[model samples]
Structures are given as C-alpha cells and as structure tokens.
Target: MARVIFLLVAVVSVFQALAAPLHSRAVTSPQCSQFNVYASAAIDEARLSLGSINTGNDIGNARNILQAQLSLLDANTGVTEIADSLLTSAPPAPANASATVVAGLQAALASLNQIFFLADNTTKAAVAAANASMITALDNAQQAVAANCQTTLN
Candidate 1:
C-alpha cells in the first residue's frame, strides 16, 4: 500500500509538470517594436548616405545626412526626438525596457558611432576601413532586432 501511494504521488507530480506552460521567449514590449522601426529607418538612411560618401558624390551633404540619422539612435538626445522621425506616433521607450530591446538599441548605437567615425574621414583607405566596421556594426544591430522584434513590430 505504501509503494502504491508513492507511485501515485510521483505520477501526479509528473502530470502537473507536463501541464505547466512553457516560457520559451520573453514577451516583447510595444516600445521595443517602436524602437525597432525607428532603428531600421535610421540604419537605412545611414547606409544610403555612406554609399554616397564612398562614391565621392556630395561628401558634405552625405555627412550631414549621416549625422542626422545617427542622432535618431542616440538616447542621450531624448526619446521624443527619436519618436518624431516616425511617420506614426509612438511613445518613448520605457525605463524598464527588456534586455533584448536594450541590446538591440545598444547595437544600433554602436553602428551610429561607427558611422560618425566614418563621416570624419574622406581618404580611400580610411573610409574603406571605417565602412567595413560600420557594416559589421549595422549587421549586428539588424540581427539583434530580427531575433526578437521582427514578429512583434507594428
């Protein structure tokens, strides 16, 4: 009777465990989705400006555009400025943003920094090196966003 009761308790515990919900992924926040959209636009703009700079076509204009794009990803400038660039209205990123969201934004900011470095140099070799670094940073940012924000963005 003692052995039978022990086996029954074990079966009940296993059934309870099987019935529990799995939390495979974190629930992405709305702020993350907004930031993802804004970051994508900013990165696209920077890429276009970088290409123009690389081709030696209106370097000054390209630099200005690149700077403007970089500002959008800069958190120190204020979230309102970043949200203003969006065609649709979005609330500022929450202070308690998820780790995934913060990681994505940090990656974008690193790319922005790389672009800023690229903007200051016009030499072929310097520009080539900066461009390579900028591309890698941008790729990392994009991958970060795709990992969590793709399915959740508006």
Candidate 2:
C-alpha cells in the first residue's frame, strides 16, 4: 500500500509539472512592434528635415530644423529605454533589443555630432564625411530593426 501511494503521488507531480504555465511571449511583442513603427517614422521625419537644411540660405530656418531633428532623436532615445526594459524582461525568448537600439542610437548621435561640427565650420571635406557617416548611421538603424526587432510594425 505504501509503495502504491508513492507511485500515485509521483504520477500526479509529473502531470502537474507538464501542465505548468510557460513564460508569455506575446505580452511584450506588441511593444516591440509599436517601437519599431515609431522609431522608423521619427527617423524618416528627421531625415526629411535634414534634407531641407541644405537647400536654403536661411541660417535661422536651418537651426530650427536641426533643433527639431534633435528633439525627435531625444524622443527616440526615450522610446528606446522603454523598449529595452520591455524586451529584456520578456520571457520565453527575449531578443537583444537593447543592444540594437544602443548601437543605432550611438551611430546616429555620432553622425549628428559630426554634422554639427561640419556645419559650424562649413568645410566641404568635413561636410562630405558627415554626410557619409549619416548615411551609414541610417543604414545601421534599419539593419538593427530588421535583425533584432521580430514583431512587424503595423
């Protein structure tokens, strides 16, 4: 009777273990989707503003545009922080969203810094370098999202 009871208990325990809940993966996937959409939109708008900067001789207008781009970048940085927290804590299968965001942001900020220096000096070579850096940064951002962010941004 004692052996039979022990076997019964063991079977029940195994059944319970098999029925245990897994880490929820769907919970944070939406956040990732929203983040991808918002970040892409923000980057696109900033690029548009930056594109306009070279066409005009108005220093004041250019400064305003640059300030807008900076503001957008700042907002993106905040979103990135939120995304990092959400993605890292997500269970089942968490992607390295934080690393991707950090890399993209670092590259973008470096490009922006270089551009600011070039703008102040108005040197052709420096401007060319800044433009190339900006292009690379934008590409990095795209690749990061494509590689790290799994959710489709709708």
Candidate 3:
C-alpha cells in the first residue's frame, strides 16, 4: 500500500510540474505585454491623425497628419521587434504566422513610403487609402501576435 501511495504521489508531481509552465507564462511574458501596449498606442495615434487628415483640411494640415502617422508607425518598430522575438522564441502552430506578421509590417512600410510622394488632391486620396491599408495591416499583425503568442491586450 505504501508503494502504491508513493507511485501516485510521483505521478501527481509530474503532472503538476507539466502544468506549472502554462500557469506561469501569462505572468512572465513581459515583452509581449509591452508590445501590446506600444501597438495600441501607435494605433490610437494613427487613428487620431487619420481623423484630422479626413476632415477636408488644407493640404498642409493633411500632410502634417500623415507625417505624424508615419512617425508613429516608425516608432512602432521596437514593439514589432518584441512581438517578433516572442514569436521566434515559441513559434506558433502554423509556421506561416510569422510570415503573415512580416507581410503586414512590410505593407505598412510600403504605404508610408508612398505617402511621402503625395503631390496633389488625387495623390492625397491615394495616400489616405494607403494609410487605411497600413492600419489594417498593423492591426492584423497585432491580432496574429495576440492569437499565436498567447498575448493579452490590456
């Protein structure tokens, strides 16, 4: 009877050890948490700037808003890096998830590059569309990270 009890205890200990990591990960994923915060802030800034740009404002005002958004997107690079690190450390089940995130980041950067070439109202409209595309790409990337990395957006 004592041998049986000892075996049971050992089995229970093994199970507990296996479960502990999952429980601890949420509390320990600081880089993912930081990434979420930075991503949210950058998204908020982009939204506000996009609002200003869409107000039928003067070209200069629109340009200024776009420039601000570009800066925000640029600043989000660090956060993206953190997200990348987390993903790399523990790749998602779907191996292509990291590639999706990369594609999104590239799309945002491409849109930003195109924005700087705006020369007329038509071009401004195109820039606006590109900005919208960038936001969608960034948001998609964030969602992918949250889903695959077990990240909580708070």
Runs in model 2 lying further than 4 Å from the true structure: 26-135, 143-154
| Residue 21 lDDT in candidate 1 | 78
Per-model TM-score versus the true fold:
0.30, 0.34, 0.33
Q: What lDDT does the true structure give each of the candidates?
A: 0.44, 0.50, 0.51
Order of quality (TM-score): 2, 3, 1
Worst 10 residues of 2 by lDDT: 115-124
lDDT tens per residue, model 1, 33-131 = 555455455444444544444435445445543553454344223323333323233433343222333444454444444443333445334345434
**Model number with the top lDDT:** 3
- In model 1, what lDDT does residue 141 have? 40
lDDT of 3 by residue, 3-101 (tens): 999999999999999878442111225554554554545455454545545525445445555554555555355345545544455332233433444
lDDT of 2 by residue, 1-154 (tens): 9999999999999999999976543233554556555555555555554554552554534554455456446545644554554455433223554345445555454545543333443333433443454454445445555656543212
Whole-model alpha-carbon lDDT for candidate 2: 0.50
- What C-alpha lDDT, on a 0 to 100 scale, does residue 10 get in candidate 1? 99
